[model samples]
Target chain A: MTNFVQLILNLLIFPGGLFAVALGLFLMGIDRKIAARLQRRVGPPVYQPFIDLVKLTRKEMVVPGTAHLQAFWLAPLLGFAGMMAAVTLIPIAGVYQGFKYSGDLLVLLYLLALPAIALMIGGSASSSPFGAVGFSREMVMMMSYELPLLVVLVTIALKVGLATGGIATFSLSEIVQFQLENGALLFDYTMLPALLAFLVFIPGNMGVVPFDIPEAETEIVEGPILEYSGTGLALFKLMTSLKMIVVLGLAIALFFPTPLGKNFLVNLLWFFLKCLVLMVIAITIVRTSTGRVRMDQAFKFYLRYPTVLALISLVLTLLQR
Target chain B: MKKLLQKIAKKSPWLYRINAGSCNGCDVELATTACIPRYDVERLGCKYCGSPKHADIVLITGPLTARVKEKVLRLYDEIPDPKVTVAIGVCPISGGVFRDSYAISGPIDNFIPVDVNVPGCPPRPQAIIDGIVEAIKIWETRL
Candidate 1:
């Protein structure tokens, strides 16, 4: 009973629900501020997203007459719930130990696809032509990015399993443990390509500039989400921010989760700093520096670059084993 | 609780542009308010959203031409309640150069409740920004 209670607490209070949401919003706010500063302009305050959320809750929700009401109402919750679960699976070194499961990584890989799937469902259910276009484009982007992500995960699983005298371990805690003892994989020459591939994958999965074709504001007017207003739009925004945390957390757990000292508070702060740095590099700078690419070009770019990069690491890890 | 929510919500009024049927001049100035750093509206916690559903401030450009009058009204109706309309340029306010043309049907307030008017042949980005600020004030009361 105590264990069950602890699980619930972990899911709702500490690392998963409220804390993750706050941290995610903070990271997003910082991303916007940095992007604005990069352009030599004063941006909205860091609390802007929080204000937006509050505002959305008070606004009236307008459902399209042609919308599939059930699906449209349910879509945002799917991604939000998935990310909430995904956050608990990621262990922060010396801070919060993640839920221990032998196959959590595999589970996470599936959970990570939920947001994209939700977007596609919502888009198609909206009955808008723009929504249909967004649905197709989102599917292509997901397919292209998933391949490289799969390859990268397999490579990491192999690297850890080989060193620990196992076939493969898809456990995140074990991965973090291995790195803590044997040094982070970030410094491993063979893991470099995989790290690069993951870096490339970040912007794509986050749907920032250069790959935000699905919700291209100028072209499709936010596509699937164009019709969603009030609380629905707020939920979608929260889901994206939560996703930012999940992806960045996963990368930290995978690569450089070396906690600072043994102090709990210090380690937590350290973990946040790492997330901020990663967000700036992988999302902010890249988004600020680039323009949207054509859907075909983005598909081809993901397939060619990150896919090959992750494949190189997979082959190297296999050869080393 | 409602009052506090209204206070917090007032800070994030998203703007949506509706091109009723002008010569694209006001639209160009509207773009500058977002694109040019010198006149950045984001600092006001204003974002230019693509859909009417997400908008809090309706920025109507161009004259209300007979061809697009119906579509414009439909678009305005699509914006959820508690929205303030800001007519940009003389066109939306009085049809400007297109006034009395056989195809023109503006002075937009005839159909939409325009709350603010930024009048210029093509209003300067600063004036448009000022109009947006005025609309946000009206929007706050409604919220």
Candidate 2:
């Protein structure tokens, strides 16, 4: 039992954690490449992410004088762990059998929220007024985005229920199985509004583009992350990258399900393609767009409008039935 | 023994950057230098050190404004011996655009003896990395 427990921990922490980190790094590199191509500049190599993390880890960690060091330090770790847990829940290359029971959509939602909460708490504890202000804006962004997220979830759930004739299942595998049987959500005419909701949610979820107010560098000086340096800063960035991957992965799984391949290599390739396509769309928009939105304007646009779109999607699903 | 030490230091000089009172243009470029893969400072054994005490090369950005003068001096003083200070960007090298401002002072070398002067409003990331590489060469030659 002890050895088995150790093995389980190793599996969860090593390959599981390692896979998320590597994928996160790759996705960030791809984001940079896409952003560069959009701007007509030669981009950095893909290994740029690995180089950055290595350099940061070796650097000294600087704790601000005014910060509550305890909270500040713990926040990034919490955010990182939460993101890793979410990644583990989602099937990467194989069948959803690995963490199947643990992979509930609701849990993924809560885990997805953890990174943002960590940012808020960490920023608020930094004791910088700017950091405080950033936290305030982040909270508003969170509040605004939360409604549309829920609506999308419910709409997807409703579609699953409809497909199964009221046999409700929130498991990710069941949803994929439903897709495999009846075809992808992208092919469903009724899913067009949900697709719109998904599109809007992508930017909001990654905190990229016109929606990236929390850590707006030009206006807020990396916002909540202003006081962080060294390893703490690196961890925060790593978590952000991981969160980006999780958001894109979830988006792919929901909107576009590529059937799992017979072997690991084929499945992995398909998985990566889906992820890359989503990441390219996300980062391209980020690079081409000019940012800096007032807190109120951002909330008003994302929450009110997208919620209506989600409602339309739900109604359409019912109408199709 | 000392010659061998100098050789090692020259080959792998770890850098630390301090932002006294930057407009942040230089800092972003500085970060970009470390980030963009072509000038990947990490492959050269050069990295951004966390603190001055552990740093071999100190790359100072922005003009030394009134508020940060003492802090800058203290940080410069804290670095261990055989350290080289490189004034990065135009602001730190000549006080750049803020030279005439009352709140601003002269170049960073005015506060601490700077070994190199890398001049650009926000020097390209590659240039900064190259400047550090040059500073390491100086350390190997003289010390």
Candidate 2 structure quality by residue, lDDT tens digits, B1-143: 66654454455466778898999898887776444454566555565545353466888888999988998898776665567888888988778889889988766766698898888988877777778878977866754
lDDT of 1 by residue, A1-321 (tens): 999999999899999999999999988888888988999889899989999999998889998889998998889999889999999998999988897889999999999999999999889988899899999999999999999999999999999999999988899999999999999999999999999999999999999998999999999989888888899988899999999999999999999999999999999999999999999999999999999999999999999999999999999998987
Which residue segments of model 2 deviate by more than 4 Å?
A1-15, A93-95, B1-85, B88-107, B119-143
What is candidate 2's CA lDDT for residue A249? Answer: 72
lDDT (Cα, 0-100) at A3 in candidate 1: 99
Chain A alone, TM-score for each of the models? 0.99, 0.92
Considering every candidate listed, which one attains the maximal TM-score? 1
DockQ of each: 0.88, 0.13
In model 1, residue pairs whose N, Cα or C atoms come closer than 3 Å (at least 3 residues apart or on different chains), thus clashing, are B22-B62
Instruction: List native contact recovery per candidate, as a fraction of 1.
Output: 0.93, 0.00
lDDT value, candidate 2, whole model: 0.74
For residue B82, model 2's alpha carbon misses the true position, in angstroms, by: 13
Among incorrect, acceptable, medium and high, the docking class of model 2 is incorrect
